[model samples]
Target: MSAGTSQETPATARGGLFVTFEGIDGSGKSTQCRMLADTLRARGLDVVLTREPGGSDGAEEIRRLVLEGDPDRWSAETELLLFTAARRDHLERRILPALAAGQVVVCDRFADSTRMYQGLSRGDLRASVDQLHRLMIGHEPDLTILIDMDPAKGLARAKGRQGSEERFEDFGLDLQQRMRAGFLALAQEFANRFRVIDGDRPMDVVAQDVLDVVAAALPERDGDAGA
Candidate 1:
């Protein structure tokens, strides 16, 4: 792992797990992320639930700047820079600490979001995005749960939600379609650490699949794996 992307202490080495959820908007990954965290905690595990662009104090401030403004407020490159800065702060202030304390850190989104977003928004900047990550943020989650869903449905779900954070969500179906493909490709590229969950099922079913993936990856303490 690169210095900028590494946890203060390796999560596995410290009995912690860092898991991230990624998907196009309305993929239900957010709900599943929370559900998984709750399930883990109920099983007697320490769990920290956080989200990208706004996990740590500093990152939250950056999130406001990135998510609340006009869509074109910042150029693609500048926006990616802002995201990287926020991610760095999130790692240093919240995520890394939780992992060092042996807590499962479940992030709603991580570096992969940047990779896909920029790849879709500013197609030519994908290389820059990867380079920046390599130079300043070089860590991968123990597992990434990609809630795969149809873009049209995902877009409708995102638009139906009430939020001022529609900057990304407002990109519409076409972009969401591309993002879905990007995430699937990413899953293939990082198959060892990626779980592509079919999210078209009922919420309960989706949540259970997510739980199963996580439980299998990080067996619970004592006899709690099935808990």
Candidate 2:
């Protein structure tokens, strides 16, 4: 929370909506991000569905390195730099372009994830996270949807995915619990843009709740006079 002072969107910004989904691992934010993008596109809105650490080509390369290796493959400091580099590429090539063109940007994860994963989990590097963010990435999402879920359930779901990106999940339940608390605290820290949603419900029900929240926040475009 940069103490309530933030640089407004870069001048090229039109009335674009930058939406990012964030939560503890397996909170189903990725699903909701997809659903929201599809729903908004159905309404004839130009929505750019993207994800951090892997949105653009360069970032996607970085993703393979950070997410596929062992949990301890990189130290927290090194991981932070790698993630920031990826995000910078993502914002430069994908997110910012879409926003400048007045398109909706729906991202699976963003800086907030790093703020917790690296900022708190390994050590107290939160100030470093904030400082780096302010210096490198000066923008925040217009809306951030946090799907809250019990760490135990979330961890089970994450491990069940059995994907190559298990590096983070491999850190175990303790890390998930800490991340859950960190995310919730972040919601308080950035109350203006954070909307917490219960992720324990049926997927469809939770999706609807997410949709309703986003539909309200989105600015009415010419073709999207109503969501």
Candidate 3:
């Protein structure tokens, strides 16, 4: 599936919801996504756990290129195109199919990250990338959990865990600060669909807050207790 192609299906056919986690490094997105997926599964809901820049085979290939490839080799346009390409494959193969099967799709990051990282970070390319998002993934998440945290604190946590930084992580404080601002702006823009969670809190507290938000967004599933 190419980025521009639309895989149209009836609204009724889309039986499940798509929820994405957005935040800077070490903001607990991965952990929260997993916890949420597990909770949903325990409630007898079919759930899919996935991540951006890598989900399907093609996307994973692109992920390697984007994350580990020569930094000087790719332009902003090249980066955006590769990311979108991966997203197209992911949606056609993983996301859409899972949602159609009535499974909740919990993704670590999605279009919002692109908007913040590639789009806003590059400034001039922001408009074009946003256009690509509209062209490619026309659907937005039913709910977005923005794990808000201080970039420095998050970076320290990430460094402690990984022992090293990737190319993106190596961009230093300025870029991370800008990306944080970008995420905040996006959250404001999509207030109805976005919930900002303080990631500075304890892990259990953050998890409980996330669950509360998810439960509120999906009130219909409240009666379904966890297994």
TM-score for all predictions?
A: 0.92, 0.94, 0.89
Candidate 1 minimal-lDDT segment of 10 residues: 1-10
Candidate 1: tens digits of C-alpha lDDT, residues 66-169: 98757777888888999999999998899888878878899999988998887455466777887788778767788899999999999899889979998877
C-alpha RMSD by candidate, in order: 2.9, 1.9, 4.0
In candidate 1, residue 153 scores what lDDT?
92
Model 3 Cα RMSD, 1 decimal: 4.0
lDDT of 3 by residue, 3-42 (tens): 2233433222477778899998778888999998888788
Rank candidates, TM-score, best first. Answer: 2, 1, 3
Query: What digit string (tens of lDDT, one per residue) describes model 2 on residues 1-227?
Result: 56246564532255688989999889988888898888888878888999877999999999999999888899999999999999999989988878888888899999899999989997788888888888888888888999999999999999999888999999999999999999999999889889999999998999889888877877655444344
lDDT value for model 2: 0.86
* Residue 196 error, candidate 2, Å: 0.1
Q: Model 3, stretches more than 4 Å misplaced?
A: 1-13, 163-165, 219-227
Residue pairs with colliding backbones in model 2 are none
- In order, candidate lDDTs are 0.84, 0.86, 0.79
Best by TM-score: 2
